[model samples]
Target: MATAKKLPSGSYRVRVYDKVTGKYRSFTAPTKREAEHKAAEFLRYRVDTRDTRLTVREVCQRYINERSNVLSPASIDRYQRILDKQLSEDFKDTYLEKLSESIITDEVNRLCGKYTPKTVKTTVHFFLPIIRKHRRDLELDDIRLPKVFPKVKEYPEPAVIMQLFRGDRMELEVLLALCYGLRKEEIRGLRSSDLSGNVLTIRRVMIDVGRTSVVRENAAKTVNSIRSITVAPFVADLIQARSGDYVTSMSGQAIYKHFSRVMAKAGYSITFHDLRHINASVMLYLGVPDKYAMERGGWATDNTLKKVYQSTFSDQRKRFDDMVDNYFSKIYDTNI
Candidate 1:
């Protein structure tokens, strides 16, 4: 607390330190009480004004800074990328108090023209929570966002994929994804110590943040993602043969590039991530129950397993449908 002092002119003056401006602010009045009250009011107004004047970019950065210790490196990197690249200068510079639905809607519309609906949605979703943390009065319910349609991905047959990568440099990476339904991060984080006999434990993940890779020990995408599953005999042998602290020394980029080249050479257009889907598809084809499949794949919920991973191969679906149609056709002919 600061006290008022008598001035040479018989008036009272009070000085208070403004930490935000790194300067002392002075208030003068005819009386000591009035001068102290004026200084108090000015300090209160300064704090309120400063908060209202905070820009979107500033608030977002502050939020990221405050949560840096708690948030994963991948998450921090994503937020930083969004702050740097995704947000428009106008949107970022807008004062938090001036933020409105119209402004947000315009930004979203602008994003839609340049990016996919999913990307626009992700950007908006990431931006909104930071705003709400500061401005609780802001209502976002009426903001219309573009609808995101699920992509129908076609993956190569398990046999074809295995045959292609059997002796390649990325065989272990492919095997982990295709056989165990491991995410690329999990595949990259695999260590020699995580393997015991035929069982392989998924206890960590290595994610790409900008140009660098970050490893999170005893951490995974989800609680269920941290699991252990038995590997086949041949898979175990491959693991045993690898001589390093990690199962594979290849970086995520190298694995993706090699996978893309192999798939392209085989006349298939697919991504490294598609191998996880192929694993799920194989499980579905073999009549594996949802419970077992979910456990094996480390999926958090049945809904996710069914919605994203569980898909019948086009050829397999056609073959099964054809069998049913033929049976029905024979019955109709007999009745006729």
Candidate 2:
């Protein structure tokens, strides 16, 4: 407790007992009210300083260090970025005991607004294992996250894609994404030695993990992702002709920017990742079976290939409808 006293100089002074120093600490303010407020704030700071066991930032670092062995390098990198760049300063400095449901939900909503739903969900996932590890202190059920709505992806027509390949500098880059369904990181990670016998092995992935833009080479996203992919005859020829350590000298960011520019010149706007969707959709359109398509694309699960990647074009569906109508008409005429 602090006591305020009126001073001869016309200002009020508050004196608080300093337990550690075994002395009274005094502060002067213009008025008794100001003196009291200042003293109370100082007392609160002291209490907070003494009570803090661990900060959110410390917990995040601890989580990353403890789980580094189990988590993928990409996952570890993402968690580090979330803690460094995404989380609020107040949220990062907050003590574990002081964290509340309102605080967590507010931050989640803010993060969802800034990034994609999938990104938000993944970022929030880092908190779960950490909170559970301290279950004796925090109630995991207290924090509830908002639902992440799935987004509908758009892809360009096959003909339009073919037109863009006409002597474009990025033709090879575009072809790799559309023809092989390789991720941009996978493309950057490709080495010349990985290609042989018309098959390319996905052994490494290059990612910009932190704020510094320092790219890191790590293992593929999953064991299935590390499998080999066989290319078409033309693609195999293209790889054989290349004389470099990597498929391209361009960085991952450069590849994406150049690809976007090429697509824009062709009068369409789609991301490089959307090319993966284009590849899968074309395979489905060509009547390729799910198992073979899944194998070629290195998808461990068919649900994503069937639902997320496979999309039917309206023109293709119309053609099927016309064929069905013609068949039914011919059968009825024969009976007549």
Best by lDDT: 1
lDDT of 1 by residue, 1-336 (tens): 599999999999999999768899899999999999998877654544567689999988998899898999888998899889988999999998898878988888899999999888888888887776666566678878889998886776666777787678888788788877999999889998899987789999998888988899888887668777767666777888899898888888888889999999999888898888887776787666566567678875645645433454346544543443343234333433
For model 1, the stretches where C-alpha displacement exceeds 4 angstroms are 1-49, 301-336
lDDT of each: 0.79, 0.68
Model 1 — TM-score against the truth? 0.73
Instruction: Give model 2 RMSD, 1 decimal.
Output: 15.0
Worst 10 residues of 2 by lDDT: 324-333
- List TM-scores for all candidates, in order: 0.73, 0.67
CA displacement after TM-score superposition, residue 200 of candidate 2 (Å) = 2.7
Candidate 1's displacement at residue 218, Å, is 1.1
